[model samples]
Target: MKINGFRGRLITADHADYDTARAVWNGAVDRRPRLIARCGGSADVAAAVRFARDHDLEIAVRGGGHNVAGTAVCEDGIVIDLSAMRAVRVDPAGRTARVQGGALWGDVDHTTQAHALATTGGIVSHTGVAGLTLGGGIGFLMRAHGLTVDNLLAAEVVTAEGDVVRASADEHPDLFWALRGGGGNFGVVSSFRFALHPVGPTVLAGPIFWAADDTTEVLRFYRDFAAEAPDELGTVVRLGTVPPLPAIPAELHWRPAVAVICCYAGAVDDGERAVRALRRFGTPLVDLLAPTRYAAFQAATDDTVLHGWHYYWKSTNLAGLSDDTIAVITDHAYAARSPRSYSAMFHMGGAVARVPQDATAYAGREVAHNIIIDGVWLPAESGKHAAAETAWARRFLQALQPHRATGVYVNFLDSDDDTGRVREAYGDRTYRRLAEVKAKYDPDNAFHHNKNIGPG
Candidate 1:
């Protein structure tokens, strides 16, 4: 608390906000940091890092606190909390935005939408920008623009030695490359500079759902249509019960279904035409596809996956949806212990697939989709409910393993994941390169709390 050069508030066990400060997005993670350093800027972050090193205390860096893995908080370490620094500055002229470490996708979307400029971000608006970008962020705009890291111009990082440095294409190029999809093993990202693209004030976006019996037909159509769909049209398939929302038909609320969530980043009229075939393909239970404010559409699923829920997630990359794979997922989709839980598949192509695999540490550039099975349960529905709910996700993932590609998405993994899972995220080549970068920056492994890539 008395460390010099650290000009930020520190919360201890006895502090009034200690309990709230330690909470993460996943209610399952209950950790108590010995000290929570509410960082105001890079200086505070650096000082906190140095203070932890000097005291032989472990360090956990908190940025948006939405990793679900709960690496944001440590059992008895120092948490360099960046929640207080949620400033976003947009440069419309340069087509870029500078975001603080703790800023969420909603913060970025709201600011960038004001200029009709945006970047690829998380599907869930409240997801952390830092964590998502580092793990190759994918969303509705990914096919149109690219992964969040593809647009990442630079980052200001606080290294293990407490040095503040900038990583970019021209400066610390290797570090910049690693930060793109290497997860947060390097350091605490104080701020990020991202290249933005012209998106929309209004875009054609929403979900179209079909009845449970139509899962096979809808999924096959989704696979075919997505494969040939234009880059401007982004698509995702969710096989689960419908979320109860105002925009949805009350008659179809909580009904088991297969749905296509669409987003077109171009002119609304063009978007309408682009997805007309999909909208008319089936006897839909509910079709909410229409022109919507871009930022609002980005947050469409916010309530369904709200914070403070006990969350379990497992996911993998795939070349495409095989019939066997489809059958396996559909069989388990509606059987989730929690009605709110779902199995999801995100279409990956366009700008995402065009990038070379070796271009960045992100390993899934060649894959066609990313499949995620999420088990969600509320606090009151935890205990035995949590175990049963998570078992569903685990089994769902296992059943589809034979159909999955070589690697997993590092971002989807939780704290309990073994080192093999981390290695599986990036293959031998990328993993070795990341380990070398980690050795040069954080040999002592002070930042090992995350989905770690250790020192070589």
Candidate 2:
């Protein structure tokens, strides 16, 4: 391996720490990179890119290293570790924040909250800003504001030629447009400038749980209710086993239940009124909804799951959840191998749909629901559970055939899954445009860890 005179630590396969460094969030993926460059700054990232290009090595970029497909690390190539470059700067007057590529959502949230501002981010605070935003972030604020990519004002990217350039509406506009919803295909983003919104130090949010037997009815009502819900009200309907938390009764622990996790991004009184109908709609087993800090709501479920757990997730966009789709979801929910596994459906046609299809690379403009079948299991039983989850997800997706969108969300993709599905993620026109951008910025496809669009 060639060694450049860079300041960052370089770990080879021979190093004891190399194995630990290459391991990704998904325990299922076990890749060994030839060298791991622990980057300290943009200069270090540039050097790594240059070295990889010159030596003809495949490169993987690691931010928070939380990619579900374990794309953050690669096999027999160079891994550029950005964990050491985390830094967040907030400009309250400008209502914008500039974040380093390595920074996690937690880091951005904490820094921006100091000024009573926030950018759209993922549900999990542990998710890296770079990967999530680039892949079109959808979260609690999505209804009130928009996807994180929609909030992105500008970015500093390191191209294949090892030159850093700014991409935005006015500068490198085509690259900017492609970067909005395009995965890491265009270039390596070093820093991102995102427009922030006045979210709360406090907001109304929590989960309402119903019995397993009520799954069908709850889903039916939720589908109708969410469609007409105000943009201020964002919700996700989850069917999974009730975890053994203090709030859940002992008898209910480890048993199946249907839950609606709601977040209201408005005044306390208004939120209460907006969610009152849901409280009255069903005889809930538990109602944990109340006023809490926005950050707290975002971080509420963060600790419930651990890293390195086996995960298999499949998703599809829906015009609306039909009766047949609901039936399939309920059936699969009951058949899920692990208590931790779940079938979730989120309403997706508010702020996200407002944008024109050609405004960005994300093509699911008219999609009403975002359905996901997630299987999480212990390493020992992963094989069986993975098979079950894959079968269930495919079955449910096929059942929703009538309401299906042309594509899938890139963020929830599985590495070994269909390349054709990746094409579906971006419609034909967008895919061609993205390919052109890929050629311009990365002709050799150096950054292929994400949902990639090959060079033109």
- lDDT per model, in order? 0.90, 0.83
Judge candidate 1 at residue 226 and give its lDDT.
87
* lDDT digits (tens) for residues 1-456 of candidate 1: 576798999999999999999999998899998999999999999999999999988888889899878889999999999999889999999999999999999999999999999999998899999999999988889998999999999999999999999999999999999999998899999999999999998999999999999998888888888888999998889888999998887888889999899999999999988998999997998889999999999998999988898888888887568898778877888888788888889998899988888989999888898898888888999875788877888888888878888888899887675456999999999999999999999999889999988899
TM-score of candidate 2 on Cα atoms, chains taken together: 0.96
Candidate 2 Cα RMSD (Å): 1.6
After superposition, which runs of candidate 2 have C-alpha atoms over 4 Å from their true positions? 1-5
Residue 419 lDDT in candidate 1: 53
- So what's the TM-score on candidate 1? 0.98
Instruction: Report clash pairs, candidate 2.
Output: none
Residue 109 local lDDT, model 1: 98
TM-score of each: 0.98, 0.96
Worst 10 residues of 1 by lDDT: 411-420
